[model samples]
Target: MTSAAERPLLFLDVDGPLIPFGTSSGHRHAAASDSSASLDQGNPLLERLDPGIGPRLMALGCHLVWASTWMDDANEAVAPRIGLPRLPVVEWPDLCADAGPRGLHWKTRHLVEWASRRPFIWVDDEISAMDRIWVAAQHPAPSLLHHVDPTKGLLDDDFSALAGWLRAVAPSRVTSTGD
Candidate 1:
């Protein structure tokens, strides 16, 4: 059973899911909508924030976390301006020992430390096939991983998908902000 205070964790990825094509034709049809920024020269994807969705996510009992390559700097810099709730940043291990060259064990490492024992949703533009496979391994009570594409940028599909998944996993979908 889940406690009332704990929100369902949402591991938000910065680049692909957050910043996408900015109403431009260049990347309009691109699947990921990734490109370099015209002004900042930083990845344009970093500039795309899903409007009015961050707070809703928080309200829906999601403890959002920064789980991107930018977890250290880039993502953090952009999150505040975008209204994403401050997050507990988690990092991946150095290498994938057992999985070998193409093992994609970073997901596995994160699973063990973070999501393996908790319920989580991964919002990334880069969740590969290996990621899904690894998630499947942890069934039952381990975790419920929801992959949200940044290109969609918090579209109804994203929220409904998340809400449904969360409803099933985190029965107590209300988080208390009692500090």
Candidate 2:
């Protein structure tokens, strides 16, 4: 097994990615200050994941970093409420922009700046139609930064799809189903 230093980074986001909401497995409901978004909840995919996920992700050299708006509020109460391992968070400070209703812009701008020169996958339901296209156009491997859409919280198809993607993109993070 590889050490933590060897892992590629999985930039994790909260809200739409982790929490199950909405109607489709890839669809979710994300509430913002003034507006809400529909996105994928990858949480169900990672929750109680088989050890293979962590090890495989680590084997492929993956480091999990929290990049959600909940960063500041993560460990305080939300972390436990959300069912994560303690309160792992990102080192990079946020640019701190209010996503409000147009959170897609916030994610894109922040990702562009935060990811800087590193590779990252942003899991959020708020990703706008444009951001997906924009990221694809800019990144070396557009797939490096993935977007898991849990239209509805923890749907079977979404879970299956994410498992495949994780194994495909970061073979190390791949594990058998917890579902």
Candidate 3:
């Protein structure tokens, strides 16, 4: 069996995948009660995080890492609300230095570096074909640049897709025999 460190990584995004945006989704909230929301933090949309998401993500069996612009704040403000422990945060390098091909999302290059050739799944709202093409050339291992709709955060379908891909890629290690 591969060590947990050798398992694929899941690079999570905050604004889109975790906290849905846009007024049309019906998830947009002005504020949440202090209990549900992150302690004393002021991002009203923090309430949009589905508390059930943490367990769902944990079930995927990949090493979860925060790749959002929220940086370490995701560990402090988001993790607790979703019932996740502190996860590794991808420290972004200079924005100008890591820019990839034009039209690539700003995070594309940095995430590829952070994965360091291990298979990885990048869950974010801004994934583009350009980013996929670049990673294909730059990253030697398997990768999925899964784009989540910002208007609606991760739904059941999203979880299904993530699990399917993870299982397919690392069946022996990632497959959980039970729900």
Candidate 4:
């Protein structure tokens, strides 16, 4: 049996993977001023979330961590709507923490350190070659930086790839049920 500590971390990003920007047919960006106001009235984008995603994610058997700009707001505003419990939130460092190579994502460095050599899956819309290279060089354990399309959110193929990688890295930590 795998211990809790043996479970790989699933660092989930909310905006792109959970709450899609808009339909695949079109993309929409809320004005800067409307951002905070929209959160107060209820983010219209949240409606785009597929409530079924939570179960599919949980079924993957990784330890889910909220790795979004939404922070605690993911637990407060997003969790209940999607049927997920309050997950551990990844506390982001200050803005200046981003001092990596040119194209490396701001979150990549922190996430690698947070994982602490444990295997992890970083699901975000912003993953790039730099991030992948950095994680490959820095993190000792296997890692997957799965990129989600903000316009489409997480698709069936995205989930399949994530599950596949998890199974490959930690076969004992996950049980395949033909999902």
Candidate 5:
């Protein structure tokens, strides 16, 4: 088994990737109704989370880290709902000061710095071509900036892509167990 330090870091975003904000699909309405009955009353968005995603993510075998604006709140509210243990949260620098070249997402630079050349995967809704180019130029190790569809959230296809990338980057860490 690989040590946590040796594993790739999967930087996860909460709003889009976990708690999808799709209004057209009626997911929000369903979530709202569900949230009213749930214990996490503070944020109804928590209801959209699919508890099954946690296991799917864990099955990817990476060191999961919260990289969303929710920050520590994700650990407090999101983790328990989804059956995930509290993972490390990425601390953001001043968003204004850390902004990189135009078109780059504010979280891009800090995430790269946090990875510190270790292989990593960033799963978010906002990743763009500029972010990909910048990371390619700056980071030395292999990385995947997976853009999750905010409408659908983390689906099987997304999981497949993440798992495939992990297998390519660190084959030893990926097991053959089925999802």
Candidate 6:
């Protein structure tokens, strides 16, 4: 098995992949009612998070990092609810008028920089074709820019895709089904 340091990094986002926004009101209500005691009561969006996701993510055996606008807030607010331990947060550069090529996501460049040529996976809702093309050219190592549907969040199929890619890139490191 590959050591943790050599394992691929899994850059995770919050707003879409974890807390799905397009869920039905009834589902939202049920989630809110079933909220964990440790969860922050003020942010209703936190309720949408499935506590089961953390283990599924951890099972992938990648180094998880927070790559969301939530930043440290993802550690403070979302981690506990989902059973994830404190993870490294990607510090974003201040947004300037010229972030990147037109149609490229603002976070795309930074995530690549943070990966520092290591194989990595970026799970976000905002990835575009331009971002994929740019990363392909700039990042020498294997990378997957998987876009999560904000409406559905990280569904079973998403996990399957992530696992499949990880297995192809680093077979021994992918330890479980991530189901």
lDDT of every predicted structure (CA atoms): 0.59, 0.49, 0.81, 0.83, 0.83, 0.86
Clash count in backbone of candidate 5: 0
Give the range where candidate 3 is weakest over 10 consecutive residues by summed lDDT. 28-37
Cα error, residue 88 of model 1, in Å, equals 0.9
Task: Tell me how candidate 4 scores on lDDT.
Answer: 0.83
Residue 154, candidate 3: Cα error in Å is 0.6
Residues 1-179, candidate 4, lDDT per residue (tens digit)?
Answer: 22445899999998778877776567676632345346668677667778888888888889999998888878877888887999999998996864689999989989998999898999999999999999999998889999998877888899889878877877766654236
Residues 1-179, model 5: lDDT tens digits: 23435799999998778978786656544432344344455666676789888877888888999998777877878899888999999998986694979999999999999999899999999999999999999998889999998888988888888888887778777763245
Cα-based RMSD of the predictions, in order? 5.2, 7.9, 4.3, 2.6, 4.2, 4.6
Q: Looking at candidate 4, what is the lDDT of residue 20?
A: 74
TM-score of each: 0.71, 0.56, 0.85, 0.89, 0.87, 0.88
Q: Which candidate is the best by TM-score?
A: 4
Using TM-score, rank the candidates from best to worst.
Answer: 4, 6, 5, 3, 1, 2
Question: Model 2 compared with the native: what TM-score?
Answer: 0.56
Look at candidate 4 and give me any clashing residue pairs: none
Name the weakest run of 10 consecutive residues (lDDT summed) in model 1: 30-39
TM-score of model 3 (CA atoms): 0.85
Per-residue error for 75 in candidate 5, Å, reads 0.6
Backbone clashes for every candidate come to: 4, 23, 0, 0, 0, 0
Q: Write the per-residue lDDT of candidate 2 for residues 62-134, one digit (tens) a residue.
A: 4456777656444443344444454356544444746434435555655655555455556566656777766
- By TM-score, the better pick of 2 and 5 is 5
Q: Give candidate 6 misplaced runs (Cα > 4 Å).
A: 1-5, 25-41
* True-vs-predicted CA distance for residue 90, candidate 3, Å: 0.5
Flag clash pairs in model 5: none
Please provide, for model 3 over 1-179, each residue's C-alpha lDDT reduced to its tens digit, 9 standing for 90 to 100: 23345789999998879888756646544322323345465666776788988888887888999998777878888999898999999998887684767899988888888898899999998899999999999999888889999888898888888878877787755554224
The per-residue C-alpha lDDT of model 1 at residue 32 equals 28
